[model samples]
Target: LVGSATVLCTDKTGTLTENRMALAQVWLPSGEALTLKHGQPVSKDCRKLIETAALASDPHPSDPMEVALHNARGTFAGSESSSTLPIHTYGLRPDLPAMSNIWDDDQALTICAKGAPEAIISLCRLSDDAAQKVLKAVEDMATRGIRVLAVATSTAPDRQWADSQLDYHYTLAGLVGLADPIRASVPDAITECRRAGIRVVMITGDYATTARSIASQAGIEEGEVLTGSDLEALDD
Candidate 1:
């Protein structure tokens, strides 16, 4: 029965990449981005972005992106935070591609959010001109074969609101480009699967450019993408 199976559907992050991601760059709303290098000084704005991602992420996330964001935060500062505590968590959902939470330190309450560039942009109250520029930057990064995430921060007015009450009225902080290297064995694995008459289809929430880049590297045949709306439009 296993041998008779001809189709294999799989996730992209762990199955394709090594799951070890590195922060490559950060783009602010002004079209300015910090090109990160090891052991270098991170600008105040960039540090704030990384810190926001860390605070909003899961305490111990199994997702590769969250893990990368957390590690980047640690490298920028040193050691996980010992003070801040989460007050509310807006977990990720299909409609809301981002995740956010409110954290409280002794001083004040802060709201941090992280997610797809477009999704994050929608949450931020950016002017139309600013939004277009940020989207262009995101596309540029993706064209260079890096995954991009948008991070934002705001002041939490209500300390205890239900997740559903969370609003998209936040500051447009910045965008982070992360490099998720393709796994060394993926190309060979795909080759073997093809030899066995199997068709491999990758379905992921990653950007189209990122997906296409990895697919090309892994020797997987690319086809038209069916997004949520596209699926809904299907006539099956």
Candidate 2:
């Protein structure tokens, strides 16, 4: 943390949530990993949702959808070499042995994932209690038509060696929904900037429709908005 304090702003893509997301949190307490090719679960609720996130998603294992987000977040943070990538210094592959780009202990829950809220929620296999919680989260986010990503991760130890890459089964972490998700570290830095007395603002390249939708989710009041051209004219 820094010694300054001021308003902080950030994006909501991966910065607030895990890069690799899951729809459901079916914990194999038996110490077994649950693997699904798609969201093909016997349970109606679980199967339906998981299928959607996997199928509807535009991200491949490693590609632009992920990189474009990282690139944009880098610019926001003013990170060096971010013209290529911001907070992430090296090449990142979500499935490989890597820690998340976003690692903030404080306000972990507030971290959000944005893509398709409906698609993200479908991947979860919920118990009665867990289902209610997920549903509440989904409803709260959806009513605003905010794009949400159900953030979930399965953890294994660093040294745990396995014969197959598929040895580990994912554990359900939590659901992080972002109207317009940023890189995972964006929230952390934004929070830090606020604590350290810096100004945080959002300027986007998207059309007004999507840009405003996501901005609202990032906590801007729904009213006047400005575009890139607007800035150019002001300079005149």
Candidate 3:
């Protein structure tokens, strides 16, 4: 099977980029973006965003993104909001492309959601022009060698309603741009694979631009990207 194999499909995380993740930038609902480098000042909007992330994040997360979120929350939110907890959680799934949490605040309910920009945009119920604008922003961020995740919010009268319906029709809040370093050895590995007569392909849940960026860095040949939506269309 080794020599006869014509194609090698691989994941992007450990296979391409180093699995270590860091918060690069954040685009808020107020149309403000803050880039976090060596420790930039956190604006009120950014603090709120971090607090939301803290509320939605796992206490002991093994995922890189979750660790980043919690670390960011600690940097900004501190210990005041550490007591907050989610009443309900919609865990990440392959089909959902997003995860959500509902919290009770002063007898009112608030929902915090984080996920792929495209997936969250669909649930936001925005106008055509607005959706396109956000989509454009997402694409722009991805092309800049950053992985983008959109944040959203929605309110229900109570937790029961929020739990009953998976789609709460959230409103777009902002986007977070994360950066993961590409492994130095990846390009050389790809070259050796090519020499062995194997056609390498990068298969990932990441957006096309992000995947393409890493592929280019790892010296993978340029090629068309087939997204999940594209694969679904072919099935139809």
Candidate 4:
């Protein structure tokens, strides 16, 4: 089968990338962007953003982005024990790609959420101008091959919990950019596949810009990107 194969289809994350993501950039609603470095101190607002993202993630996370958030939180803020435990959680759903966690502070209940920028932006219900600004930010990040996730916060009633995260009013805290570098062996492997007359194709759920960028790095030629919406609109 391998000898007869003419095309190879692949996923981006674990296939092309090392799958070890690192916190690389943060963009705030104020339009300020910060680049993070190892063993460096972060601004108070950036630290707060990292903390909130960590709160939104599971206490023990297996997902690459969640692990990156937790690692960033630990690097910037000494320990995770300083934060309060979550009282409730809204897991990611098919309809809503974001997940939110509610924590009870002494004064009130605090809600923190992190997920796809579009979903978080919708949850925050930003104005037309604000939403445009965020979409532009997401585009810039994606062009740089950064996987972006928007972070948000809100307050919940003391006695009542929302059945869905959308029920709460949320404020856009910021956007976190995670970088997953391409695997060292992928480029050479791709080149060899092409030499053998195999047509390589990459299929990913990532943004078009991101997919194109990674595809270029992995030595795959640029090609038409088909999104899920595009696929849905297509006919067999």
Compare the candidates by lDDT and give the number of the best one: 4
What TM-score against the true fold does each predicted structure earn? 0.84, 0.27, 0.85, 0.95
The per-model lDDT (C-alpha) reads 0.79, 0.37, 0.78, 0.90
Q: Model 3: residues >4 Å from true position, as ranges?
A: 1-6, 76-84, 93-95, 158-160, 164-169, 232-236
Off by over 4 Å in 1: 1-8, 158-168, 192-199
- Between prediction 1 and prediction 3, the one with superior lDDT is 1
Q: Write the per-residue lDDT of candidate 1 for residues 1-236, one digit (tens) a residue.
A: 99898998888887888878888888877667777888888777778888777777887777777788888888874557546458778878887788888777656667788888777877886778888898899888887668998888777555544445245468877888898888999989988999999988887777888777777777898777667677899897
Arranged by lDDT with the best first, the candidates are 4, 1, 3, 2
Between candidates 1 and 2, the TM-score winner: 1
**Model 2 per-residue lDDT tens digits across residues 75-126:** 2222322121111111213433222221222333111122332222332344
- Candidate 4 lDDT (Cα, 0 to 1): 0.90
Judge candidate 1 at residue 123 and give its lDDT.
83
Model 2 RMSD in angstroms? 17.5
Q: Model 1 — which ten-residue stretch has the worst lDDT?
A: 159-168
The 10-residue segment of model 4 with minimum total lDDT is 76-85
**Sorted by TM-score, highest first, which candidate order results?**
4, 3, 1, 2
Clashes of each: 0, 25, 0, 0
> What is candidate 3's lDDT per residue for 164-212, written digit by digit as tens?
3255878777888888888998888899899988888998888889888
TM-score of 3: 0.85
